[model samples]
Target: MKSITVRQLADQFQLEVLVGEEQLQREVTKARAHRPGLEFVGYFEFFPTEHVQILGKKEINYLHALTDLERNLHIGNIVKYHPPCFIVTSDQSGLKYLKRYCEEEGIPLLRTKLRTTPFIGALDAYLLKVLAPEISIHGVCLNVSGIGVLLRGKSGIGKSETAHTLIRRGHRLVADDVVVLKKLSEQTLLGTHNEVTKEFLALRSVGLVNVVRLYGRKAFQDETRIVLDIELTKWRENELNNELELEPKFVKYMDVSIPHIEIQLQPGRDVAGLIEAAANNWYLKQQGYSAAEEFMKRLEF
Candidate 1:
């Protein structure tokens, strides 16, 4: 919904408005074109109407030969135009005639030296993040029922060793390395791949192994709601005033909120048992029961 005017574009790229200074203040809803591969072009289609476009060096000559109607049509000016501006990529003064015509007709022109590809790529990536939908769902997300529970223990507290036991307990692997998160809506967080990553878990002794081949397709989920976020920390023997007991705490990502569970990792603890318990406890909460609150009410009685 936000837009940049021709004057703003000139300020952004340090380009001078050669002609149509009065018209140069027109707002551009989208980039007409960008240096290919840049992230700037993807936001163009988001507005209700087409606003402005980048007129590169290649198309400058063809535009000058056209008549009034032809000039308007070829320059993408059909329908009730929102008053378009141009980002001229070249510095040549040969286009002065065209500039004179534009000034007479009150069309704005902006100049920039950056190539087409790189500018567009940057524009696209930014728009994708801005326009992406985020959502939240209460579904259990795991790989092979174990392995890669993603334990984040304070240095040398035993996350890798705990994962080793979980692997030995018949839980296959998905990704022990890095997990990628996708924002699907205003309230949905979907876990997926980072494109450049492979579906493998890397342990210290063993480097990397393909999870799909070993655990079948079930271990590699395309996407799943991040219903739980378990953070592992060193054990504490003090009072358990704020210890989690199946009570849901939501985490926000890309404007969406998702339930999270933080578990403490420690020595001699049955981690596999705890993982299963966490999953089961989440199920119970989904079914409308709260063990911690229920036990507290009983104490009052």
Candidate 2:
């Protein structure tokens, strides 16, 4: 149910407000734009009234060719539907009547200098990003070896400490505590830091520290595409070991599957080194080099 106001769109694109100053707060619920070409010719059955109406060169020319009475009737029919707003592309000069009608009817009208194709593309891109499905996860996300690694575990499992060590080793932290995950597409999930805890990492005894200020801007990144998920587990007695040479596992978030790995924590273990090795191994796998598979082939020979 998220919506963007006509005023917000105008400000974002720096579009000229042709009329309907009082209707600036009108909300557009749909991301797609509709061309009123058919609607102008008395075909209003399947018209998209919730989307932003776009008037381009052909539609304007058609309007100009119509007789005055016909044009008025067509425009009046469209106005009665109460579309979210109207955008006239290319800044066409013969839109005086359209502008006057919109002003009198209090329908927000905007003008942009860009052609129809480019304007629609840009607007659609922005709206898709703003309205994309999003979810927040409790984990620490970092860019390790150019791969986004998400660390998840219980509260006292040292996830923050491990991330801090990784930052010291020249890795960048994307988020801590709560990571806002946005489904960019069917197979892509983007992770970003929560606004309240951005750039700040909390440690048990050391208290809160700003990673950006302490380790420079390179130690923190705004967001990253999450490609790997790692869960830290406490070492327990008589626990079964998972076969590392088997096919990779996956974790689903927002209906997208990401490669998943689990690491057990024990005393006297170099967790940071292990994480770095995991990232490098992931990179190698991406490049089609699997050490386990190679070793199995050698054993078979």
Candidate 3:
């Protein structure tokens, strides 16, 4: 499982370290933050140990209301559970006993100046992005007419060459050779280039080339939401030619299905132009305009 360390979170949010200096390397496995309100009141059965414990103003006020013995008992139970870390929000700084306890137990305790709600929201977003399910695809991803199109095919089938042609024609390339796809949410897949291969494309004979440097920054995009999946296949003599009325196809990745299309590869064919047209056609279909349906309507009329 992918996990983020306390030190990384502290550096990202500029959290102040109040105690547990040696626990900076503790790993946070969960994306959700936990509020220890109930735990502070001696409800220990349901306390989440994997989540980062967040103490807001209300919880702190409740803590301050308790006698030293009561507070020690409550905090001691929490410390015994060994949570990933603790965060006090809103810059409140009157928890000397809690800080001392955390220091003694070697549990990382941090404080942030952000309000409780916004801090929780931001942390949730960051964790979601970092911990989201990811997969690598052997294809090229591009933004064509605002639609993220992923081109897939066997080696030497001109996927990269087609992407290069599309780039030259003003479309932006998200990734070439290998596209790293991350499921940002249930229905959304975000595609990005592998770090070592960012902005670089490998051609058959021309070798490695930097698309961003050659065509400027406009030719490359950092990431794009994949909406369409297209596969290129070698042209066959007896292949069906129902070009106007193609059935809807979908390709599933990471439990999400995206619209899919297949294009035949042949000599003297404008594959790049066809891809651009396919992207625009997909956009039109999204707007409730289907050329194939319109043609079928005309035929029936």
Candidate 4:
């Protein structure tokens, strides 16, 4: 979990502050931005204070159409609840008076030149990324054949090296070493790297190497949704029975169950190739084709 402040949002969008500059440090904790649609209709029973309010053209016009008493009473009622902030879109004028009530309540009042739809679209996306629930895992996340694959195993078990190989084969690396995983939605887990480790991978013999510098920009992706988890393990004679996998194991990240596979490594085994195959196979499963299930059906096993 990360904390995002009103100041950060204001700075990110380059919004102009109309008042309550001192309260800009207030946190913007919710991903859903509210429009006060219910509040204006005299419904305050479920006013969501968690959301950052947006006053678009419709709301602005509605306000001006009302009598002075009605408008003041409505604005006062809403402002008293104290939302994270109020963002007026379209550079709409004549609404700065809303700033008066906002200032009285110590709520930050802001404005953006972007129209309502695009600003809200970008704002929702920004909030989704920043306020998403996050966890840190040790692995290399990559975009392989449009599927997000996470490589996890023991330390120095060649995860980074396998990822390097994948990058060379035209796949894109999302993160190496410390993979930051964020739950963008109930089922989507997005993997990324922090500033310190982004675009860099460490190998046993070679030191830290920037994949983008060597492989160029096409070999790197800032973030990718993790659809598969692949763990590499030293090949063991006892586990040979499971080598011909008929089913994929399941792993959970933030309560989302994702398909999991394990690859046993040997001296000459193509680890990268197997991982790539797993990604493609998972993608195929998504499109209603499962090799393991088909094989089992043919064998009647």
Leading candidate by TM-score: 4
Candidate 4 lDDT by residue in tens digits, 1-301: 3669999999999999988889999988889898997798789888888899999999999998998889999999899888999999999989756878997899999999999999999999999999999889998999999999989999989999898899999999989889999898989889999878988988789989999899899999899999999999988887756534555579999998888888899999999998888888778878999776677798985
All candidates: TM-score: 0.47, 0.82, 0.86, 0.94
| Per-residue alpha-carbon lDDT of candidate 1 for residues 1-301, written as tens digits (9 for 90 to 100) | 5455667566656877777788766766543433211212233344434534555655565555556666654444322233465556655445665565566667776666666555545444443443344332322224435222334445445554555455555554333434455564566555644444445555556665565676665546544455556556666677335653534576566666655555665556786677767756766777899888798889998
Give the range of the ten consecutive residues with the poorest summed lDDT in model 4: 240-249
Greater TM-score among 1 and 2 belongs to: 2
How many backbone clashes can be found in candidate 3?
0
List the global CA lDDT of all models. 0.53, 0.88, 0.91, 0.89
Q: lDDT score of model 3? A: 0.91
On the 0 to 100 scale, the lDDT of residue 141 in model 2 is: 92
Candidates by TM-score, descending order: 4, 3, 2, 1
**Lowest summed lDDT window (length 10), candidate 3:** 238-247
Name model 1 segments beyond 4 Å from true: 1-174, 239-250, 293-301
Write the residue-wise lDDT of candidate 3 on 147-235 in tens digits: 89999999899999999999999999899888999888889998888888899988889999999899999999888999999999999
Candidate 2: where are CA atoms >4 Å away? 35-47, 56-79, 237-244, 280-289
| Candidate maximizing lDDT | 3
